[model samples]
Target: MPLSINSIAPDFKAHTTEGMIQFHDWLGDSWCVLFSHPKDFTPVCTTEIGSVAKVKDEFDRRGVKLIGLSVDPVAEHMRWAGDILAATGQSPNFPMIGDPDLRIAKLFGMLPEDATGDSASRTAMDNATARTLFIIGPDKKIKLTVSYPMTTGRNFDEVLRVIDSLQLTARHQLATPANWISGEDVVIVPSVSDETARQRFPGGWESPVPYLRLVGMPS
Candidate 1:
């Protein structure tokens, strides 16, 4: 089965633009946003990566590390970084894994277990499923995942917003509502009864319905 939310992000040692790294050791208790592109030097993927570099500090401020992947080798990845920088004015210095043998792709279930070929032999369509996003938490479990089609571009700003929600909820017994943003009211978890909610959020909450209690973000 494909990895699910709350599932442990399978660990592996792989080659990255920064150097070789064991996945979990590199993560090192920090939250991680690991996304993939079908191939390097593709137009859509290039733009998305450039955008991430521009917002790199926003990710750092939240204690989240951003990494990327493409089926190309690390050398090709190094070459592509130059084009990304020239086009976007910022280099995505984050470590991008080179899955030339497709081990990392298969390990993450982005390809069939029996899939074959090195980066040179594969077309972007052959590895199209490699386009995915995994938000892993400090516990090394996946918090969120998203996969994009070859034609569509990803909205990384939305990714940041969701990460904020995930981090806030991890630290409090709260959940975000539709269209929620930081500093907005969040709903008390259904598992936390009104009585318990009172103790944790002593300031009281707005209950539009008996089952729906909304309150400001807790300190």
Candidate 2:
């Protein structure tokens, strides 16, 4: 089954660049972006990790912590991080979990069941990690998830944009519109009862259509 919002993210203990850590313990009091890539020391994964490292400050500003995972060893992570620092002039400030046994990968449903079975000769990733992105809210619930094809790189800008929107809507208790930007007006969720709607939106209630209600623009 696909993971959904409000589901408690599966917890796991794994090796990271900074040593061992339990998932929930590492995420204490901070929102988390738990992302899984197909493998490490590869082309697409290289670019993705570097981009995320570049945006570390933006995520920090929003009180979000990033944790990357894949079925690679701790040694590989150290070498790749060194290479990344040389190439991008920035060191990765986040934890990159080395899940060689697929222990954490399987728990989070990141390892594809049939991916290795279809190969002709040897299966390197029989229990390997898949390229997946999961956004966990501060409440430790899975908020959003994205699974991308191996050929494509994940979009960091889009992720940041969505995070911005989520944080804004969360603080305001209002619903975001079709292409809501930060500081833009938001739509309010109407009540099931007409009287309740009137009570919630008191100033001027006008229903252009049955399902659509227009109140004063948000201040």
Clashes of each: 0, 0
- Write down the lDDT of every candidate, Cα atoms only: 0.92, 0.74
Look at candidate 2 and tell me the lDDT of residue 172. Answer: 50
lDDT (10s digit) by residue, model 2, range 118-171: 222323344333788999987889878888877788998888878877776666
Find the candidate with the highest TM-score and give its number.
1
Q: Over the stretch 33-120, how does candidate 1's per-residue lDDT look in tens digits? A: 9999889999889899999989999999999999898999999999999999888887876999999999988988888999888899
Which ten contiguous residues of candidate 2 have the minimum total lDDT? Answer: 115-124
For model 2, how big is the CA root-mean-square deviation?
A: 3.8
